[model samples]
Target: MRCKILIATDFSKAAASAADYALQMACLCRMNLAIVHIYSVVLPMVADGTMIFQDSLYDLAEADSLERLSALAAKLNLDADRLCGDGFKPFIEIFSAIGVPAAGIKSFFNRKDMGMIVMGIKPEERYAETLPGSTIRKLIKWASVPVLLVPMDFPPVPLRQIVFTSDFADSEIIALDFLAGIASAYHSDLLIFHNRISMEKGRLFLLKEKKFLDKVAQEIDYPKVFYRHKQKDTLEEALSVMEKNSEADMLAMVHKKHSIIGELFGGDKTLRMISRTQVPMIIFPQSFADIPGPARLGQNQLHD
Candidate 1:
């Protein structure tokens, strides 16, 4: 079976933008894109007691979703009828279920070759403000595949440079190494970005971290991998400054239990770091690098 990039949409503006972004990425990579919308049928009860199956209702809803999906593909100038055995064209798949949204998403991943999950969110101007709540949070935590969070306002630019923020953790290096697809597909330059804490012991820790990053670069030995860093009062502030300096096409981070990801998403500063780049952010699970795939195989070769 052919693999595809799964883009979840709710037909909202944010979702629409995500679909568009996924379409562009899929086209660039010469991969197939599947836009999935999961909906549950709600049938109104009559006074008599019995409820009808209402097949027509579901049919109408499915038709409407397909129509909208077609419109989205049309906007991308993708021909839906053209079938490439590898799923190179854009297609729509509607999953109707009477269960948790996350469960439906998980089911798809279990049965499909899901390269990545791309979701869109509304961009906030301030990071400290109240954050919007949605099923995306649930999906991010539950998904086995990498998740790319694309802000609705972000433009689809060439992914020429990808900046991965590292805390000098081994898991972070593994996560970066796992993303060989994005790098090889775009031929992107990899930036091993780290930020030092100002209040912490200055030169010693700085030298230690620089050496750690250098070791990582040497281990990977990718010609395009480069190291960069900055010292700031806070991790969030340092990330913001680095984003400005790098003009990175994509931002990546490794999410682990009790890591900075937990703190960032748990507090009001979730949007602070996210808003700074306005670029697509890819989140890799700390333990997910071993999964079999071209990317993982490439990482193994690099290690050898």
Candidate 2:
């Protein structure tokens, strides 16, 4: 069976755009699609702290969620012919669950053989106060597979160049290996960007950069790979400059728990970056490399 790309949608404009983006990716990667809708039924509590059992409300919620999911699947199927030419239609599935959005998604994800999770973020979510409770933030923090975030306004374009931010950590090699598979699929350039503070520049930094590139060359056999090193006062500054210079179609990075990107959901600077970044971003969890070889690529392996 082919691997599936799970799309979490709330039926909003942004969610629809994300679904479209995932559809394009699925066609390119020869993968299937599973669209999920997570809903919740809030129960009323009595003064004694007892909750009222509302079977009717629960049933209504489930029914509505299923109806919406079906509609979404139909829409995607209609677009498949136009987006995926030559009658190469991808198999599409729909699912619904009742609970917290993130928890519901995690439960479904754990049971499926999915390669990636794609979700859309609204422009308002870029605000600092709103980032903490955003579902995308929670998914990025915990999802084992890559989480691709598409800004609501981001147009779906062919990925020609993917800019990956790296810190030259050991785990980056594994991340790069995984990304090389994607680059190979699109025949895109994988630009490894290393951002350092201005003070860290000089011969020692150059040596470390050279060593990292050498290791990449030895380990990753992809010929279209390239590297760039830049110094700025902050990661956000470096990212701004890279965005202007790289002309990248997509941005990728591994989320280390202690790294700035990992703290993106909480940090002020990182939140700002998310708010202003226009390109789609794919964030790999720190432990993504730990998954078995087959599972990492969403091949013929069952995830326990």
Candidate 3:
């Protein structure tokens, strides 16, 4: 069974770019695609205690939202032939909801068929203000599926090299297991990156790194996996070095509640990276291991 990728759009230029990226990914990965637009209906403050036009207002808003979604879907369908080539065309669906964006998106998670959620982030200057209390942050925080964030004007290229930041946690392993599918499909190299502040050039640190690599080797069967270690004073500095050196097509990370990513979201560094990075990013939520899907193989089946 092919999984579906849910894309959230507000009809902005950034959102449109994200939709295009998702379309290409769906075709390449042989997954279904869905586009959703959420609109809010704000009613005027009436003098009377009761309002008679609430239902009509909601209906109109929903109608407009659906119409826009349809238009976007049509545009994407036109490019399906070019992207799919001789492969099977992915099934595309469009939907509209009336309420908050985060709540509307969470409703689709109940379907249990979604493998990922894709959204677009504006450029750096706008990202800081756009993230706090925004729908993107809410989804990143609580969504059960992996969230793929595409920066505006990001080049739509095949994913050849992916950089995954890790702390050698169990959740990071689970996230790697899930990402292996895409890496295999794209024939991409998976680079496991770890950064430490300690400048100890001793055998103990070297042994620790070797142990982590050995564990990954025993766990993940992918042959193209590699590891990279760096010494840096801060996460931001480490990220800068990784971004500049790796030349990766995408960045992947696991977001645990108490992890560095979780703490970064509370501040501005992660937001800056999200806005400044030229490549797309895939964030695996803390609950990724619990999500039921073919992409998330069980521990018993992982080695198979």
Best by lDDT: 2
Better of 1 and 3 by lDDT: 3
Work out how many backbone clashes candidate 3 has: 0
Clashes of each: 0, 0, 0
lDDT of 2 by residue, 1-304 (tens): 6667899999899898899999888776767899999998977656886666699889989999999999988988888888889845789999998888998888766654777889887867766434533677678767878888888867778888888888887778877886787777678899998777766678998888888889999998789999887777766677777678756788888875655554654454434555667778888888887876443663222121
Candidates' TM-scores? 0.76, 0.86, 0.86
Error of 3 at 149 (Å): 0.4
Q: Can you write out model 3's per-residue Cα lDDT over 1-304, one digit (the tens) per residue?
A: 5578899998988899899999887776778888888899887777867756779999999999998999999888889989898886788899888888998988885466777899887664355433433687678777888889988877677888888888777657778876676777678898898876577468977787777778788888688898887788766577767678756788888765555454455554445456556679888887787666554533223222
Q: Over 4 Å off in model 3, which ranges?
A: 44-52, 124-133, 199-204, 258-272, 295-304
Comparing candidate 1 with candidate 2, which one achieves the higher TM-score?
A: 2
Q: After superposition, how far is residue 30 of candidate 3 from its true place, in Å?
A: 0.9
Every model: Cα RMSD to truth: 4.9, 4.1, 3.7
TM-score of 3: 0.86
> Model 1, which residues run further than 4 Å from truth?
44-55, 70-99, 123-129, 198-211, 218-221, 258-277, 294-304
What's the residue-level lDDT of 200 in candidate 3? Answer: 49
